[model samples]
Target: MTTTTIERQRLSIQTNPVDAEFQQQLDQVFTEDACALLVELTREFRPRLQQLLAERQRKQARFDAGDLPDFLSETKAIRESDWQVAAIPADLQDRRLEITGPVDRKMVINALNADVKVFMADFEDAQSPTWQGVVEGQVNLRDANLGSISYTDPNSGKAYALKENPALLIARVRGLHLWEKHLQVDGEVIPGALMDFALYFIHNLAQRQKMSTGVYFYLPKLQSHQEAKWWDDVFRYTEQKFGVPVGTIRATVLIETLPAVFEMDEILYSLRDHIVALNCGRWDYIFSYIKTLKNHPDRVLPDRQVVTMDKPFLSAYSRLLIKTCHKRGALAMGGMAALIPAKDPEQNKAILAKVTADKELEASNGHDGTWIAHPGLAATAGAVLNKHLGDKPNQLQVLREQDAPVTAADLLAPCEGERTEAGMRTNIRVALQYLAAWISGKGCVPIYGLMEDAATAEISRASIWQWIQHGKKLSNGQLVTKQLFASMLDEEAEVVKGEVGSDAWASQNFERAKSLLLDITTADELVDFLTLPAYDLLP
Candidate 1:
């Protein structure tokens, strides 16, 4: 067989085809010395993959059979008057500063005082699952009571409460499908009835306290566009039952699934008329990637730094998302800036600077808002956003800029040997992995012998691009050009061609890589910029 054919075989293995003919060919190609080992591994993996596919088929069948309970029906069964009510002030949407406080303490008061857009009082990921904690969190939010509530650290036993202006609040609720019993530390099951009661109680309290309008929710883990549609229907039913306006209750769905990416158009259409926006979710997305591609151990995630947006596939995906939201005339908000290092002052400053730079890029790219997990980070984000928003350009101009054409030479700019090189390499690897995985029809695949799947590709690409466009760079060195990057990709492809055959694996990987490289080539000017002579290192 020719060298290209060998490379194809390698690609086929990475892609994982179930076709008997392909298997036969692969078997024929294996050497006697390693044939048994490869066969054993294949034997072990095939059934597991089959099982996963079977499970998916079963779940889809259940859905088609209408076995999935209707959340709207459940929500509508409750009476509107049974919950409390409040009018959402018109000015709430126009507020500039937004604050999210972990505990409802003085945070709400601070937010209100600061006149922020939203005061998010998180419950799902932030607070303990105990009923007492839920009740307390509700009370603090409902009453806008930021004072006289002290929290003791479970580990350190240190106690503290807010003494200054509290942030305005929105609450994040537990997913309707997540059972408290499953999360209990004491092994005690919390009944469904209790969970429902808690939801209603909080809903009622918010209404009664006249906190209706800004009393929004952060919905978690919505798996499909259909799920968003269900939630919209539920919202409509609940509002009518409660005698509230159709759009009174607002929500942002966390887009964190592979399926969710395809369902984006549907999801937005489903909630377009309702109070809904998309929030890019990272951690859960990573978890989902792992779960979806567990059989491909070779595609396991590497270090966090390795994943970023400079890679072609991810950059395209993220841009597509932003474009989708913008097309719908809705907010295209950026994902969480969790990687902002806050422990070390210098590191925190550098990360904040990077985040600031990113926000500018996002806003420039047409995103309206972004997220920051911590109070400190929020302040930094606010500053960054405020600076960008201050100079917010006309929509027409932005669109024109977005539509402008560029060459492959522009997109492949070399990274000056500084940290940027590492960043670029990371982005390239991630992009290659994503292209390999998606084109191969496998949920995950290995690149340069490392395992990577869809989720990793998405997050890494989003992040890396954010860095490339916004991260700090040196001033003196020559930047890599798009032509150079194209050449680099060509070199990589030639290497693969020499190593693998034109079999299923090589075919899929090469096609995917070509598509991704073409995407990058068409979009931006890839050029390496000069590195600065001296730069302040992040601690």
Candidate 2:
């Protein structure tokens, strides 16, 4: 058989080849040997993935039936036990400011070269899982770790390259539920999360070890300690298969989901040997909050704007993260300040002040570090964290035991505010704009002066569904029906078409974005995630 045909056999699926040259590169990454290993790994853990996902649905049903989440009683001893995660490595000691962005090649370079202590290269929320996008992102990260990544714009002739003293890299792989449809092993498509994590860990381990920085990760969407344990098992198996030390791979778990927030201690304990911190994945946490309690009328959230961290439930979640992490000698990392630096001086000044206050609260409350979405906000976030982190790697020393105890009521605090027509219109606009960008293979977009990702879009659509499901009405006494949302979407489409001009508006992607947004928003039943359906539209 020809070499090209033989290579296709290894992938065991009919995927359109990017080109011979690119195919060769992919062959190297997904060689028969590598595919065989991944097949084994997938088979080993696929059942657990199924169970965990099923558990998620089961838990959701209970929530829908009026049950509220609380601390896991079965894991009480694990939480009450006196134990701490493994020691933090020197390179990961001070994560004062971490910048997050997609795994796009230019973005990878910019984020690494940005002035932050750590740059989380996201393969989950900030990236569309196109075959090219998924595979090329791996190649970019591989080159970035080796200091050989660069890009030149074909038209503008502008160039990008990594600078000296680049931020340490952390990879955030996809969650358990998503899978790559392009490449299959024995007719089964590989889990996208495994593909992302395995490809990075396999390729970059040696380079990072040579640099002595280690392979760090950010774990996303974990709903239970058992899920964390599943990841822990995966880590163990990966290290054993690769001949690395057991705890060589360190990860910071994102306490984003409502169920995850309740099991913080248990989650930490489950991955104690390979964990260094627990991050407040705030954007998605808010989305998950709405998803978890959507059945309860009283739990319906107000305008997303008013659901700030100071709100009862969010405040409790934030403080509890700090107290739990500090007590266990782990870092309590804060969530993203999603504001980008605006051109208007007054607006930028106001946003900076707000970020400063947020960071100050986290620092004073014993957080070790925080996240900034844009490079410009890094310095501002750093300044606040530095005030508390001065001369010390982290505030892991500050045991927040005296902080007010966070109870189940605190975590499930009922939402309080007005639902306005302005809010509904805002959600419609942002969701459409983001969907348009995402369908165009851009997962991260700046809309209305804020950097948004899949998490933001998730919140946008999930909130709409909750509003419609619960028959929420705006201050104008209008019910949030599908027709109401579609009408606003139509108006927003015209506004966007005008903003982007006729050339963009007439494009196929723009049309698809509109159709996709309408489908998700106005569907009879809520779509679990917009990305799942959107993934089918990718090349």
Candidate 3:
């Protein structure tokens, strides 16, 4: 290493400028002891993390060569064994309605006071992770834990603060694929997951103590049991370093990836000491469905809108998950209801009906709880789950084991729907607008009455790319091609411009978003994620 890189390894990565108040919070969060823990983590586990990521690329190569992911033959013994995860903490028992948002200060305050069962402050898909967003997210969570977070709107001159009995708080860290580029150790970027976890864990020491509830987490996008083990080790290591009990840090894993679906048993087994549940991250699961099977022409999915929870493949996935999780004594939480409360009265009624129906499907399928993106959705979703749970804290006893109809074929079954021109156009428009907002440092944006985050954006572009790759014909009988997508993209950009108006079109990063989206959609090879390239746009 160079002299400067070596010297910097001994020092902490400096943060970008924020307001005076946030700078003070930053100083408090990054004490001398905290920096030491960060550097120690970087030195010890960074190599193993890289090895695990390399294994992902290796497995994908096998899949591209016509190998399919199935239950691991080697670990069949573990799957058949009788075991269960550690007990669920009292605070996380009733997660019937959980709301997730980016870790902005105002959002943190609002989500905490939203009267849901849990408010998941997200550092993953929902967070843009600009230097300001990352720094302020930590600051906001610390203050929220202390019951002192507040916000005063500059535009509306309105004040906001947490309510007396706020929802339970959980921090969802970034996936293994993302690196926090703002910080480096030994001339390399640090894993964003580690950064979020370390900072959140250390800063919330008081929160854990004062509430007598150990730090809880929501782990995202883990593709295999090995990744879950990595996180489990990190949790135990952090607990040991802090001198807390080994199982003090509990977590719920999002089974968002296709490979992860087949390994639910192994994943829970690996993290049994520190895990309580497995969530059905439906959007990312759909994105993974396309990405993992991209080379298989017969498996090209239909419209994004048609890929709802009730579809055969998705229902099978959910049923199998409910059976697996409950059998293993873990909660099977449902997916996000991304509907925003529309302003039009009739439209809002339809949206509520949709959200309610979705939660009903989950509750009936034996999911213990469900996720909602908007606060207005809590009442609708909670009522349905409440009816299912009666007075119980959760639905762990509602196991669907006896009448289960899911099989491996069900999980990988070809999604059935028409590939319509309107669907293709909708994907282009949503992806363009969401990417523009993302590059402009807003990770979560409402487009066309639904919350759009990285997972949904990934589904949009990946679906289009897969369709074009296989030369599939749309419902309108036009073969999807690069030229056609480019044409649709141009038209949709104008449509978005007209809809968002010239001021927004002129002010935001729409042009940059358009260029990136077009390049990825028509590229010869499929890109893994949109955010990897978009992260360069952030400071």
- Computed on alpha carbons, the lDDT of every model, listed in order, comes to 0.45, 0.86, 0.89
Candidate 1 global TM-score? 0.51
Ordered by lDDT, highest first, the candidates read 3, 2, 1
**What are the per-model numbers of colliding residue pairs?**
70, 0, 0
TM per prediction: 0.51, 0.96, 0.97
TM-score, candidate 3, is 0.97
74-190 in candidate 3: lDDT tens per residue? 999998888888888788788888999999989998898896889999999999988778878988898899999998999999999988999889999998999988678777888
What lDDT is obtained when candidate 3 is compared to the true structure? 0.89
Residue pairs with backbone atoms closer than 3 Å in model 3 (clashes)? none
Best by lDDT: 3
- Write candidate 2's Cα lDDT for 1-539 as tens digits: 12222333345534664687677667667766567667777788877888889999999999989999989878889888898889899989999899999889989999998889999999999887777787888899999999999999889999999999899999999988898886666667777888787788888999988997678899999999999999999999999988989788999999999999999999899999899999999999999998889788889987888888888899899999999998887899999999999889999999999999989988888888999999999889899988888999898888876777789999999978888888877887788888878877888899898999999888988888888888999888999988888888888788888888889777738778889888887777667778899988887
User: Over 4 Å off in model 2, which ranges?
Assistant: 1-13
Count clashing pairs, candidate 1: 70
